[model samples]
Target: MPDYNGSVDYLKKAALRGSRLGLERISELMERLDNPQNRVKTIHVAGTNGKGSFGAMLTSILTEAGYTVGGFSSPALTGITDSFRINCREITKKDFAEVMTEIIPHCEAMEDKPTEFEVLTAAAYLLFFRKGCNISVVECGMGGDTDSTNVLCFPLLSVITNVQKDHTAFLGETIEEIARHKAGIIKCSRPVIYGGTDLTVSDLILREAKKKCSEFYSTDYFRVSDTSSDLSGTEFSFDGMGDFRMQLLGKYQVMNAATVLTAVEVLRGQRINIPDEAVRRGLEKARWHGRFEVVRREPYVIYDGAHNPDGIRSAAESIELYFRGSDIVLLIGVMADKEYGLYTDMLGSRIRKAFTVTPDNPRALASDKLAEVFRAADIDAEPFDDLAKGVCSAYEYAKANGLPLIALGSLYMYGDFMDALNNITE
Candidate 1:
């Protein structure tokens, strides 16, 4: 293949490189490139859910501490060319093109070409190193053990946000087995900060972390803030961090905040010197879009990409707590791989009018199928063929009837909703 050095061209080449879901190719590629991951401190994260949100919070806090932080997040929330980012922005198109040009020859030199994720990760490691970041926060794209991002053997710390059942085709069937995959991000010598969850699956993660010689810190060690969820934002106070505020909504975010705070304490022991003020500031400034993100007001519009049972439960709680008695109209779309009935059953009870549609992905479940799930639960659900049409129908229903509408389900349709709202982030 030609050495493509433009953003669009590079992405085309990247697409042509098929998926190889193993770390061996990435290990060899990074090794040949002088292991740039070793040149800087890193906070590696892995989990079935909340990895993106937690990573965003950690990046914000670390940046507030006056550190130049580079981050590599999977399934990009924005940008098309690269899966890597620096200071919350995607790597520049020119930089991505240049890296692709350099990486092509190296791939050709190998006995076999590197997979798409592996090549992108290699480029990111080099980019972050060259950018002079004090640290990098990396989120594993899949499970940790065989994930390409696991190449870093001695990160400054490892974080497993919260493991649940997802990616069963690769990770495993049960929660304990899934936790093992997520816990693979932990290294023997590094410290691990884990979010507190009530699952025995969480216990498995703790056990694995201890077995690996990690200094594991759990939320049980800290006093969690009781946060109130509202459209304006979430508010809570802790013993040490004092009264903290966040623009992010949801009670689950309060748990994420606790995890971030615990991590700050762990980093402080290594003399990172992140003050309590920084923690509060970081929580306020951290933005992870599409998690109960409010896109419009005056007959409000809320967008949440709750794709699983746990995520749906959290979304349901946030809506009940904040938007109670507001006539909760819902615009829903979901993926084929998810347990649609479970999510719909949980969310159906709260929805005043539920409009179901398929997202942009080929893997999207049919809207009729989703509507059937809602109807099975005795919800008055309607089906729309397209996302834009469904959104319009929901908006019209809300506008005519004077109710607030929530557009949610799969993240695949989130971009569509955001675009329809003139591309605003929450």
Candidate 2:
């Protein structure tokens, strides 16, 4: 009875239905618009984490090679427009509103309504083709097989960054099940590049690629040598790709960069003309905001979005390596489905204290419960009922003790945490 408008408010309403992973709704929605996904060339990226950073790296290098690259990643980090990018620039609010306006009616009219991610995927497809992109790198929202983005007709290639235990309720209960879900993107006999370290996952992906009669490339043999990592980000040489540096921190990021290079090699094999210089320049310029991003100095603070145990382990490795003996405090929040035990076990010994707050999401773990997780690991923990107070208190404690504070977990928390952190007095 009510009509949706061009305003972002309508998109917010669509998102409230939450995540229901499937391809059927998106398939029908694409049919309504004559299927824009089939008109464009795309590279599909899927993983539990680091996939966004990998996409960003690939986008930068491709842009350096003189292509108009469209990007679609999830969670919208700071704003609704953060999910969509063309040639490394975000789609303007005006353009985003206009595009969604055209697509909203079809979504509203669908008998089986599409989820927000499905609508976003369709919008990205339409935007990529309509905007005249040479090629676009699209990241999956969650598990690969049933993810709405899998509706792609035929992509240049499929990249599976890594498979870890995450979104278990939706994906499945085991790593094998999860790997099967991620391997779903291999289609149309397109080549696949597997970047995961897990042998089982890689073998599973290899089987899927074989089933599709597709070529498969793995990052397993790539040697990273003469490496150095600190607060300035990682610098290393990868198996003849030459020396490279990425502004994004952590050693895992170095591996992620190497994976991008592996993909670039595959692209070059397909007659794409990405030069060695583009790879070097792009890695130096690639910036994926909020993953181990340092937002302030003096009493230092970082904003990281390490939500799962595996991701947290990677982040923890980088943090420990960079600030081995320094005084550190943690400001954390997490989702309801996450197993927080490993988070505490790995990070507890390094933190002076932890201040916990609930993220502003429907599935966020309560602040008190998160604090309980930390305390069970012998971490000194404080719980806050209000996000701002928690941030201010954490800031004050870190400042008083001359410690660096890390605000970690849930991508949902970064927007709110940064807003609160900005208001604190230095």
Instruction: Score candidate 1 by lDDT.
Output: 0.79
Q: Which stretches of candidate 1 lie over 4 Å from their true place?
A: 1-13, 16-19, 81-83, 423-426
CA-lDDT, candidates in order: 0.79, 0.88
The TM-score of predicted model 2 comes to 0.97
Give the lDDT of residue 323 in candidate 1: 71
Could you list the CA RMSD of all candidates, in the order they appear?
A: 2.8, 1.9
- Please list the residue runs of candidate 2 whose C-alpha ends up more than 4 Å from where it truly belongs after superposition: 1-5
Q: Can you write out model 2's per-residue Cα lDDT over 1-426, one digit (the tens) per residue?
A: 223244467777778878898888999999998999988889999999888899999999999999999999988888878899998888887777767877888998988888778888998999898899999999999999999999997899899999999999999999999999999999967999888889888889998889889999998544888789888778898877678888888758888887898999899988889988988888888988878888988788888899998888988887888888775899998898998867887787789999999888889899999898888888899998688999999999998999999988898878888889888765
